[model samples]
Target: MNQPRPIFGTTIFDGSQARKGYALNRMCFSFNDAANRAAFKADEEGYMRSYALNEQQSAAVRGRDVLGLLAAGGNVYYLAKFAGILGLDVQDLGAQQTGMSKEEFKARLVRQNDQPAATAG
Candidate 1:
């Protein structure tokens, strides 16, 4: 069997991670509904418990630690629902992924955009 390759800074969401994150992803999926989102907002710990999230998953959620969530087997798509509840955007996630502040990430993006596109030889 082929082993999964390791990434330097983040976890790769694959079949194993999917199985590990099933409950967490399911709970995040529920956030698609306003009622469910409101319920989570009203009672964060209770909501997580109701979903049967593991300790690591619960801790990541509580810390708002995006990288930690990924390590805990979270899928970004499902996590996006949770992020929405926190009023975060993809840039915020990107910042976390790169270990930079949101403003730093945005500045990096701007700097990259200002670079001229490379041409094929």
Candidate 2:
């Protein structure tokens, strides 16, 4: 019998990368809100514009590519914020399997990584 390999599917970011994601999420959330949505609709580019972000930061948000954001400097906290803005409830998703909390899921990832790799015959 062979043991199954642990699977990881989520992207994780840290440091400045996380901060960028957080800031981007706040910006996106503001734009997506009903009241803001109306204003955004009136001036889409103006609303989408972010003053705090440099060219790379702006590019990261515009791309909407999480991995790209990380490559361009983003963190996990920011990623979580982005997920929230996108209406992706990480807590709910985490709880789906045995009611695990998001923190628990993150901890599990660490533990899983520490374990020896599984081999199949």
Candidate 3:
């Protein structure tokens, strides 16, 4: 038997997840069009309906919960479009995903970059 995957407080976007999130991701991809983005801004509910999102996906979108969205199988790249609609960027999503405040996440990134890589002896 295969071992269970560890929970790292983040969802892995696997094949199952991709299938589950197809509608949501496709809807997000539509946001690439200016008109579609404008339409979404004009009518959030109608826009969601157009995508035929399931209750869980719809709920996640309404709540603006990044973690919830991930749990609902939302792909990060596609969800970036959705987040952009709310004036949030990847850093903001990263903060939400990692359960850190934006400032804390930024600080962490800086610290990580400052660290020297291990040299192979």
The top-ranked prediction according to lDDT is 1
lDDT of 1: 0.95
Q: Write the per-residue lDDT of candidate 1 for residues 59-93, one digit (tens) a residue.
A: 99999998888888899999999999999999999
| Local accuracy of candidate 3 as per-residue lDDT tens digits, 48-119 | 999999999999999999999989989999999999999999899999988899999999999999999999
Q: Write the candidate numbers in order of decreasing TM-score.
A: 3, 1, 2
Model 3, total clashes: 0
| Candidate 3's TM-score | 0.93
| Candidate 3 Cα misplacement greater than 4 A, ranges | 1-7
lDDT (Cα) of model 3 = 0.93
**Ten residues in sequence with the least summed lDDT for candidate 1:** 3-12
The TM-score that candidate 1 achieves is 0.92
Task: Give all candidate RMSDs, comma-separated.
Answer: 1.6, 11.1, 1.6
Query: Can you give the lDDT of residue 2 in candidate 3?
Result: 88
Which of the two candidates, 1 or 2, achieves a greater TM-score against the reference?
Answer: 1
lDDT of each: 0.95, 0.56, 0.93
TM-score of each: 0.92, 0.39, 0.93
